[model samples]
Target: MAEVKASMAGNVWKLMVSEGDSVDASQDVVILESMKMEIPIAAEVSGTVKELKVKEEDFVNEGDVIAVVE
Candidate 1:
């Protein structure tokens, strides 16, 4: 399993993938909004999305797990 984590403290702006979705390595799984900038959080491995730990508009800290891929 791989954990897609937040790159920085921010509000989750969008979810690019949902549970049971397929993802490739380096594919954007989430977009975070911080200081008016949009940052993409990517999956580190190619796999099916197993879970989403955050939702759009949710606040997250750097290093927080956003999704699980397996």
Candidate 2:
């Protein structure tokens, strides 16, 4: 399993994948809004999405787990 983590503190602007979705390595899974910019969080490994640790508009700090893939 692989855990996708946020790269910076921000509000989750969007989720690009849902549970059970298949994704490739480096695929953007979440978008974070901070400092008037949108940052995309990508999957580190290719796999099926197992869980989403955050929802849209949720605040997360740097390195916070955003999703799980297996």
Candidate 3:
């Protein structure tokens, strides 16, 4: 399994996939809004998305797991 974690504290601005979607490494999976920048949360490994831990407009912190892939 692989975890998709937030890089910094931010609001979840977008979610690009749902459970069961296949993804590739470095794919833009989520967009986090912080410090006036749209920081993208990317997949670390290629696999099917298994879970999403945050929703749009949800606040998240650095290192928080935003999704799980397997």
Best by TM-score: 2
lDDT of candidate 2?
0.98
Instruction: Give the per-residue lDDT digits (tens) of candidate 3, residues 1-70.
Output: 9999999999999999998999999998999999899998899999999999999999999999999999
Candidate 2 lDDT by residue in tens digits, 1-70? 9999999999999999999999999999999999999999999999999999999999999999999999
Better of 2 and 3 by lDDT: 2
TM-score of each: 0.98, 0.98, 0.97
Ten residues in sequence with the least summed lDDT for candidate 3: 33-42
Local accuracy of candidate 1 as per-residue lDDT tens digits, 22-69: 999999999999999999988999999999999899999999999999
Looking at model 2, the pairs that clash are none
Error of 3 at 44 (Å): 0.7
* Residue pairs with backbone overlap in model 3: none
Candidate 3 off by > 4 Å: none
* Lowest summed lDDT window (length 10), candidate 1: 1-10
CA lDDT, every model vs. true structure:
0.94, 0.98, 0.95
- Stretches of candidate 1 off by over 4 Å are none
Error of 1 at 14 (Å): 0.4
Estimate the overall C-alpha local distance difference test score of candidate 1. 0.94
